[model samples]
Target chain A: MPEISYRQAIKDALAEEIERDENVVVIGEEVAQYNGAYKVTEGLLERYGPKRIVDAPISEAGFIGMGIGASMLGVRPVMELMFWSFAYVAWDQIINNASSVRYMSGGLINVPIVIRGPANGGTNVGATHSHTPENLIANMPGLKVVCPATPYDAKGLMKSAIRDNDPVYVMESTLLYGTTGEVPEEEYVIPLGKADIKREGTDVTIVCHGPSVSVAMTAAQILKEEHDIDAEVLDLRSIRPLDEEAIITSVKKTNRAVLVEENRPFCGVDAQIAYTIQNKAFDYLDAPIQRVSTIDAPAIYSPAVEPEQLPKAANVVEKVLSIM
Target chain B: MVGFYREMVRIRRFEERSLRVYQQGKIGGFLHLYIGQESIAVACASLMGDHDHMITAYRNHGHALAVGMSMNECMAELLGKATGCSKGKGGSMHFFAPDKNYWGGHGIVGGQIPLGVGLAYGVKYKDQKGSAMAFMGDGAINQGAVHEAYNLAALWDLPAIFIIENNGYSMGTSQERSSSHPKEGLAARAEGYGMAWEIINGESLFAIRDGVGRAIKRAHEESKPTILEIHTYRYQGHSVADANAKKYRTKEEIDDYRKNHDPLNVYRLFLLDQKIMSEDEMKEIDGEAKQEAEVAAQFADESEFPTVESITEDVYWEADNPDKRTSEGRLFFND
Candidate 1:
């Protein structure tokens, strides 16, 4: 196993897919020459040339719509939205054409497209820049939303998303881009909607993803040593095809649940997980489902409030202890 | 010009039969007939090779029939039967026949503009030698997406021909009332995007053929986008709802346009003067076109509607499993 960062895993997946299929192209702002806003496409431009690596104008609506048009002609495009905040300008293309084209076409077309970008709060980018829009995308029926918490899942799931015949929304967190983990250097893939059980325990089930998955794992280890409460941590890789069975199985085993997310509290991913738990396994629960999420407010710029707005290991521990 | 006269006759008789079917409640949904813009489709279609692609606005029955879409399929689609081009799913507004290189008969006014550029991009990306034409109405020129498409096509030097059928109205509103400047619509707008522009009278088939030919050649040779504005008018109301459309425009104005600028009459006069077609031959051609449209309508009337049991089918790409209940759970969330 080779250790790689989350950013490298995404780059490797894109590179491999492009090399495998000549029809696969990448288009975004600064994707061709500047490598990408986050350097995730650093060496792709030189390898693929200008035909495969397209640096579009600053208009998100124009390029994203162009990607859809290209996809209609049998070219699979992996579009980068620069940042999650910038996607608002092209919401018409994403929601109107990208999400609804399949159902509206009555199965005559398959949209093999991916819109990848970094989401969630960190690095003091202010309110407009920092947002975790997982729930907003998950609400759409035609889109498949995936957010990998580690390097292995990022590489494997991204490869699967690129090959899938549906539009996949790969929501990455800015905080998790540089984080490193063991990634296998072979022909392997982790299919979409398969949840990974990070640690096995019997007392409490902790569900998380993206950057918060790391916090949940750390909290699970601390609870095991100090509090004497064994916590089960499951990293949910995809939100749209959410692995509800694995979640119900864990909840059925532990009899207690704590849902953690970095997004705001109202209508967050935690609410969906908590709702599913209560609806599916209400009788199996020992206590009411508990949620640990960022506060419901515009993210403050100060360091003091930023930590509070982010789901931390200590907060996960507190939520898990409270539920146990 | 002779070809334009025959195509206009065909379009006129086709739509006349269609209007009758619609009156009898045989056809459903919004149906925009291309009666007045006959010369424009013929003139522009003359420039397209078999390898090139074409996409157009909702006023598309004539274009689809002209560009090799079987008259039976187009009529069946209008009748909302299962044998239509989109398998009876897309009505008069949406018809996609990829085999004939007719990308779509899109409903959105300016939606096909960017897709035309994408087709041109694909042609170039695949190292093919052909130009793509995107036809839009005068009303669609006001959309923002069209401007974005123009800029991108110019920025990339894409070989795309953007033709605006300046029929002087959008639904019920006239161009003078809707737009700021009445003179220069899409042709002048192309100048801002650094593309060449041409303005031609759509009533005159000779002028339309010359203008479209030059535009296509320029797009192919220079590898640059071109905007061609064809000044035309619609004889019918916007759709079936416009049967009594006297509130929008005066009857006297419609009479004057029909007398002076009717594309079929213009071409018939040219053909008669050139001794290419006699009065009897023209009458014979009109009768043949009427018979063809009548036969197509019969075929559409005999077709059947799709069964209701296939409602949940084709929602996704072949991921059906008996154990999964929800659509998403079957494909992405399988245990």
Candidate 2:
């Protein structure tokens, strides 16, 4: 095993899948000669050539829908959006077509595709550029969503998403691209809808995913060091096919829960997790569950205020304290 | 010519029955009847080879039947029955048969255009000598997704034939008001994308055969894309719910199209002139088509609705097939 950045881990998974499967192709804007907007596709175009690494024109609705369409055929396309905010233009293609085509066609067709890109706030890219859509995507039944914070989960989930028979939306964070974690060289795939207990404890449960996983870990450290509360940190590697069992188990042990995410409080992923915890672990609860979420604003432009808009460790600690 | 005539008749009869049941409150959802534009889909289906694929908008009963789908299944779909082609999951708007390479009857206006181009991309990817026909109405011509698909098809040299079935009106809005016309009308917009463009008289089955045949040939031989404006008409409302089908346009206009330019009548006259079939045989074929449609409606009426327990089925491939699903946790959250 070796430590690698989340960014490098994604490229490694793509290169392996492309080699293993001839049908696998990377289609998106700037993914070829430009090596992707985030450089996650660097050296892929040269390695696989133009057929496998397609550089689509800057048309999200066109290329994204085209990817879904191709997936209906035999092509397993790994489409990249420069930013998930751009996916709104192809919202019909994703929600109406990719998500419903299989179910609508009586399971005759399945869109075996992966739409990956950085989807988070606090990057200073104004309202139009920044978006956290894991909650919105997970809400759709036919689609699967993954939000990986660690390099290990990044590689494993990316590989699995490509292999999955249904459409999988991989929500990567630009802020976590440089973060490193242990990744093995052997081929492996982390199943969707699984949770990992990052740091176990018994005082209170801090369940989170994607960028908020790190926030929960930091909050756990703070709760242990100062407040003398051994907070458990549970990272949901995948959002849909959500790991409610892990959350309930953790909440049952701790008897208190604090859910967190970088999405709006209303109808967010944490909202679902909160409901599940109350329903599945009601008797085990010592207090009403609490959660720290991105403020209700969809996107905030001010760099100074954007940091506060994200779910912070201080906010998580406070939420935990209130529930404890 | 008689085979083409039979397919057109089957589609028209199927649509009439679907419309009847729809008006009677038996059929649910939108029913976009392909009454006047029978020849376009039938002609395209007749010209299809093993590798050629076809997709269309919601007005798709014509294309589905033309591509060899059974009327019983299509009628069952309209009735929302368990044995429907889409197992009742897709109503009138979405019918698919991947086995026949008929992509779908997509609901959105121009959404299927890009998907059609992607189907063409697959043809090229797999080294198959085929093309994809993406049919739309004049309304879809102005959609942003359509232009985007055009650019991709032309740029990538994907074998996509973007066919605009330009019936006179887009819903209640006439074509003259809905879209702007340049020097050569909507199809000529393909020139902007550096693609080939043409207009075809949609009523004449012979014209569709020659025009669409050449376009499909170009797609297969040269790996090129074409935009064909097949000028057609619709005898019914945009959907059964559209109250102003007759109100939006004069009865005289509808009568004029029905009397003079009806695709079935026009092709029937052409076939009679060429002695393709006897008048007696033509009458027999029309009777058989009506009988088949009646039987299909009866079948739909007797068929069962999808089971209440099966509501959660087909939403996820992994959830349906537990053996292959590697993911843990709840794929479904609710009861």
Candidate 3:
């Protein structure tokens, strides 16, 4: 096992995939000479040169559409968005073209493109820069949405998404990019739609993905130490092809579940997960299923109000305590 | 020359029949007719290489026919039948045939511009000697996506030909109302992106063929993208649903253009003048075109809808592959 940052894991995946497949190329703004906005694509331009690592203009729709078209013709393009919020400008290309091309083409064409970038709030980047659009994108049928909470899953899922023949949206968090975790140096891929139980417990299950996984883990630790309550922290690595059986199985064992997410509560991923639990595992649950999510409002710019808008570990703990 | 005349007639007859069928409530969804703008697709398709690709906006029946898609498949697709080009999933607005290198009939205003550039990028990346043509309307020229695509196509020197069919109106609004610099024409904006560009009379097949031929040649030889603005018109409303086109544009204007500048009639007269065909021969081509369109309608009407079991199928390609599906199914955590 090797200790590496989440940013390093993503770089390793791009380097390995570019080496493995000649058709694999990375294209985005500042990805080439400028490294990257967040430096996640650092050193790729130096290693792969200008052709493999392309620098695009400040045109999300233009470059995103180019990636989709290139992917249709057998080029695996890893398109990076400076921030996922910027994807709104390219929504037609992302939702209509990339997501529906294979189906609309009668399976004659497939967009093997990975759209990767940071999609997190609570950084004080204001309303425009901060967005958690995993729920918005996962609502599309032809796309696979993956949100890795650790460096290990980030590297493995990036490699898998690159090789997959469908359009995959890799949602990364700026908060998790600097976080370090143990990752294997060998070639290994964490398959999509699998939920991992980070800390097993018998009392309550905390279901989460992306940045909220850490919040769940912290709350689980606090609940165990102070409240004498055992909490299970389950990390849902993939959001589209949701792990319904894992959620149901966990809820059946723990008899209680709470979904924690950084996205707004309206039509969020937790709403679907909570519905799945109540629909499938209602008889086994002793307490009602609860959700801990960001408040349903525009992201605030102030640091104090921004933290209040986002889901904190204390919020998860409060939900758990209320359910108990 | 007679071949071009025949294609124009065929496209005209097909569109005329499509309008009739749409009025009869046989065809559903948005039905955009290529009634008056047949010469652009015919001339451009004639100049393309076998490996070159094409993508266009929703007004695509003429392009599909010009690119060699059988009339039966095109009509079946418009009628939403199983045997259509897109397997009936894509209606009139989304016709596609990868075998013929026809990328799509996108519905969005300027959505296909970037995809067309990407296709050109793929051709260059693969060292292919063919180029790609992305056809849009005059209204789409204002889209930021199209501008962005133009910049990249020039920067990367991708072999892409962007054809803007200036049909004067986008849905209902005229180009003058929508364009920022309508007085100078859309081709003038291409210069800002550092792309080689030209403006051609969309009515003349020779001008279209010559302009597109030069652009295609440059793309094949120099790997450069060209912006071609073809001044054209659509006789009917934008779609079958927009029968109120007369309310916007005067009938005198419509009749003036139809009587003088109809692409099919112009090309027919050109063939007769060139001694390529007699009056009898021109009449025979017109009759044959009408007969072909009739047969296509019959075929589409006879074709069945897709099976209900296939509703969930083709959503993803991997789901169609049994081996991959089973193996990937095993990889699921629940399984």
Top DockQ prediction, candidate number: 2
lDDT of 3: 0.89
lDDT of 2 at B84: 97
- Native contacts recovered by candidate 1, as a share? 0.23
Each prediction's RMSD to truth: 3.6, 1.0, 2.1
Ranking by TM-score: 2, 3, 1
Q: Which residue pairs does candidate 2 place in steric collision?
A: none
All DockQ scores: 0.36, 0.87, 0.50
TM-score of chain A considered alone, across all candidate predictions: 0.97, 0.98, 0.99
**Global lDDT scores for all candidate models:** 0.81, 0.92, 0.89
Single out the weakest 10-residue window by summed lDDT for candidate 2 chain A: A294-303
Candidate 1, RMSD to the unseen true structure = 3.6
Q: Write the per-residue lDDT of candidate 3 for residues A135-242, one digit (tens) a residue.
A: 998788778899999999999989988988888899999999999999987899877777889889989999999999999999999999999999999998889667
Please give the TM-score for the first chain of candidate 1: 0.97
Write candidate 2's Cα lDDT for B1-335 as tens digits: 67988999999999988888988999877889999999999999998899999988999999999999999999999999999999999999999999998989999999999899889999999999999999999999889999999999999999999999999788999988899876687899988899998999988898998999999999999999999999899989998889899998999999999999999999899888989888999999999999999999999999999998778899999988999888888888774
For candidate 3 chain A, the 10 contiguous residues with the lowest summed lDDT are: A99-108
Q: Candidate 2, residues A192-261: lDDT per residue as tens digits?
A: 9899999989999888999899999999999999999999999998999888889888888889988899
Ranking of all candidate structures by their lDDT, best first: 2, 3, 1
lDDT score, candidate 1, position B120: 75
Query: If you superpose only chain B onto the true chain B, what TM-score does each candidate give?
Result: 0.92, 0.98, 0.96
Displacement of the residue B214 alpha carbon in candidate 3, Å: 1.1
Name the candidate that leads on lDDT: 2
- Candidate 3: misplaced stretches above 4 Å? B182-184, B326-335
